[model samples]
Target chain A: MSSQDYWKANLKLLSVLLFVWFIISFGFGIIFSEFLDQFSLGGFKLGFWFAQQGSIYGFVILIFVYVIAMHFLEKKIGIKEEENE
Target chain B: MSSQLLTYIFVGLSFATYIAIAIWSRASSTNEFYVAGKGVNPIANGMATAADWMSAASFISMAGLISFLGKDGAVYLMGWTGGYVLLALLLAPYLRKFGQYTVPDFIGTRYYSKTARLVAVLCLIFISFTYVAGQMRGVGIVFSRFLEVEIQVGVIIGMIVVFFYAVLGGMKGITYTQVAQYCVMIFAYLVPAIFISILITGNPIPQLGFGDTLVNSSTYLLDKLDQLSIDLGFSAYTENTKSNIDIFCITAALMFGTAGLPHVIVRFFTVPRVSDARKSAGYALVFIAFLYTTAPAVAAFSRVNFIESIQEKSYLDSPDWFKNWENIGLIAWQDKNDDGLINYSAGKPFEGSRPIFSDEFGSQGQREIKNLPTLDNSNEVYIDRDIMVLANPEIAKLPAWLWL
Candidate 1:
């Protein structure tokens, strides 16, 4: 991929992941919590679960996902760190 | 051995370990001091980052805050952790690419202004001192409670111990010492949690245990907690109390603040490669999530345990932990209406009537609520939320090892 294409792809990936990040932490966890609370996950209210633990789990997974994605992207774009270093 | 003696031994051992690491890894040059010669393993750096990020507040006060705040506390839970996403995605790799020693150095060079660098330095100093003040206070509180020393003496001991390690090792020493600290702190945090999880919900993992049914009851733990909260006139544990806007603002502020913290950002720069920096952030979040996820469970468990153990009990009949905390001024009780039973309710006990105790009494002072000639004496008990986490193992009657 061209350098510009690589940058664009990276931005797109970031936006998609960040959007997920917003929905999990702020959307489901906060704004729609009462609505989500109507459902139960295991013994926790779904909303409460999202707010307390679900969001945090989501964040951890999100970062690792981003890391893996970037690694793949770097290879695909021929921007490998070893080459640059 | 007595818990106090055990505390002394454990604390002494940990201090020795930190000092030993400092001596062993003492920086030979400024580069080693600043960035560990930029040779740290990503995972090790991640653990050190976790230790640096999860300060005394996360270890001691977070669950306590969540216990009292309930749903309102999710702001902290999400805010603190979610920032890692921003850091990992937006800042870490790029900053690693830039490869600067300090945040101010990056700001100075990137902005291409000496003025910007000076401003960054000033801000860094201000923020760091404020954080250090909190950590010092936390150290003192822990020492005073566990070591049974005066707060000032505790502060002095903490300063001396810190001075030895910090002066001896610098960043290289701190990196490895912090890795050890991460292990010790995480173990300290999780052991009690695992024990309490099993005791309360029969689930070994606190994260899952929080959602499991209470061991003796058919009802879900959260369901039972919600009922208990209502019984005590507090909001349901699952109920959201703060305005959505307030929660949003607070969460946003905390998330951004976590990302913007100079010390944390600097941790990313210490890794060998930009790719490693990305991986390190992931690992840091993973380590952090262990405590972050478990803290809410601890909060819920402690809140329910605290209410069940103390509420409506006669002041004279209060548990030893309650009295212990009271002696430390973290808990206080007054028999409002001259009834020996303590009335622990949600909100300020004296909202409508003039408080028998002056507001000037502050946090630590004991206010005599007796013989208030002017107002109806309805206010009864005052408990600082901080005591909840420290005294939790005791309140739940966990084994002595978990208490330490």
Candidate 2:
């Protein structure tokens, strides 16, 4: 694949990752906090859990997700820095 | 005659070590100055980043903030540490790949615009200076209490020390020095905590002690803190009084803001490889979590102690500890009803006695409290939240030498 194609795929993956970020933090944390709160998890109030601890856990997950996604993106693009001539 | 002198001698030696390190590690080139030639070890960088990030707030003020905030205080815990996620994943490697000396340099070069660089620099100066002013003030407050110097003199001394290292060695000197500082500060923080935790819970591990039932209390330590908080006209420790929407937006804003902070992102750039940047962040988080997890426990313990000790006392009978803080202008009680005693109600005023009433009173009553000024000279509310942390160790009935 050419550099142009690689950049295109990278951008697509980025958009999906950003959407997931929005869903966990803004969606579950705010919009669906009430829905989530119906189910108690350990010591935390669901909404408060999402707001405090849950969203944080989600963020760490998202980071790893991006890392794995980026690794695949690098492979797909054939432009991994380690392989550069 | 001996111990105090020994303290002075020990503190003086520490200061000398810092100065010597600053002088020795001074950087000549801009690259060396800004990123330490991008060759820092992952572990060293982690320690350095921890100190750089902890600042006076973490060392001196965070536990107090957590004590007062309770469960909502987790925002600081999650938001602050969660930022490392943003740093490690979103910003760190990309910025390192850009291979710049400063954050502004990365921005300026990436977009290929001088104007962008200039704007970035301007914003950097504004943000850094505003935050630095607060840190300097914190240093002054800490110094005044520990060193027994006047606050203004403390500020001057702090500025001189910071300026010598920050200006002379630039980023290189600051980086290595910060690693040393991380050791000093973490030791300072952990020593007191370890002692206090063992003293109170018969358990020295603060993290576990937080979850474990207190020695005398039936509930987990946090539940007791929550119960105590409600009894004292405050919100419960584990409860969320903030609207969910507000919490979500604020947390989101903070997460992004953490990722965007230039200083933190800049730390990642000092590592040799993109992989190193990723790993350094993991290390940084672990180092930071050492304090973050422990802080809430410290806060819970201190709040319980502070209230239990002082809740029933009359204003005239308020402990020597309370009076000491009042002398520093950190705590005050206005005798709203001319009552000799200060109550939890004294801190919170109703409709009329609020700021509007106070504004009117200052203009009308030549008869305000004599020793304490109602406001700082700037006419702002005078309660300094930072004082809560400083007062905690003392309020816990820790020894006088603990301040050192």
Candidate 3:
């Protein structure tokens, strides 16, 4: 893929990941939290769980997911970052 | 050894180690100082980033804040971690490509304006002063609480130690020091959390422990806590008191602030490859999560322990730990009922927020305060939110050296 095309693909991946990030943190964590509190995860109210721990766990997972996706994308584009500077 | 002497010995040893590391890793030149010669390994850099990002506030104060704020504390939790997502996904790669590797450098050159560069420098200085002030306060809290020194002495001592490492060794030295700090921070934060979790819920893992039923009880810990909060006239432990709009705004502000914090942004420059920059953020968050996930459990456990420790107890029967904190002036009891049973409820016991201690002993042998009781509600305890975390080990009666 051309550099511009590669950039576009990267942006697409980022947008998708960030969308999940927002939903998990802002959406479930705050906006729809009261509604979601009707449900329970383990002994925790679902919204409370999200507010406390779920969003943090989600963030770590999303970042790693991006790393893995980018690794595959880089391989596909034959862009081998030099291991040594 | 007394807890006091033990704390001093432990603190002294740790300070020696940090100074030793700082001297050992002193930067040789501008390249070494600016970006650690741009030679840090991704994993090491990540550890450093976690330490740099976590700060003194995260180490000492965050769980305390979370304990009191209840559901509304999500702002700090999500805002901070979310900002990392933004930093890693949105800003890291582009900044890596910027080549200059500093925020001020990026702004100046990007705008092609010396004025912008100067402005960036001014902004950094302002932000840094506030950041350092918070750091010194964290140091002061630890010292005053643990080692029995004045808070001012603690801050002055902290300034000297930080100057030795950060100012002398610069980023290169700071990174190595922070890597060590991250380990110490996570270990110190988690050990008590695990102990408290097991003590309260018969669970070793604090993340799940908070959700587990209280030991030998049918009710869940949260249910019990919610009941305790309501019985005491405090809001339910899981309920939100801050307006949703306020939570949203604060969370966003923290998110943006975390992303834009100069110190954290600068850590991305330490890595060699752009991919390493991304990976480092991931690793940093992973390290950070060890504390973030456990903070709520600590908060819950400490809150439960604190209320159980003090509420509805008489001044004559109050625990030494209670009196110890009260002597420090973080814990104040004004017996409004004249019966002297220490009544702790939602509102302040006196006017103007904090009590003005009169240095005259009350009839109950409590340190007398000049502030008149507001008499709005019968809550006679004035407990600083900071006490929940700082006083946890003492409240929970954990060993002196478990954290040391």
Best by DockQ: 3
Chain B only, TM-score of each candidate: 0.92, 0.87, 0.96
Clashes of 1: 0
CAPRI verdict (incorrect, acceptable, medium, high) for model 3: medium
How far out, in Å, is residue B181 in model 1?
A: 0.6
Q: Estimate candidate 3's RMSD in Å.
A: 1.5
Task: Show model 3 residue runs off by greater than 4 Å.
Answer: A83-85
Q: Write the per-residue lDDT of candidate 2 for residues B310-393, one digit (tens) a residue.
A: 664566666676766555545555554444544442133322232222222222221234343232121212235577666766
Candidate 1 lDDT, tens digit per residue, B1-404? 68778877988899999989999999999888888888888899989999998977788788999999899999999999999999999999998898789988998999999999999999999988988887887777787787677668878887887877888897889999999999999998899999999999999999999999999889998889988888777788888888999999999999998998888888887788899999999999999999999999999999889888988787667788877766665566655566667777765554434333443332223344332332443446667666677899999999787778
Ranking by lDDT: 3, 1, 2
DockQ scores for all the models shown? 0.70, 0.24, 0.76
Model 2 earns a TM-score of 0.81
TM-score winner among the candidates? 3
Worst 10 residues of 2 chain A by lDDT: A76-85
Query: How do the predictions measure up, each by TM-score?
Result: 0.93, 0.81, 0.97
- Residue lDDT tens for model 3, B217-269: 88899999999999988899898999888998999899988888898888888
Clash totals for all models, in order?
0, 0, 0
- Candidate 2's error at B184, in angstroms? 1.3
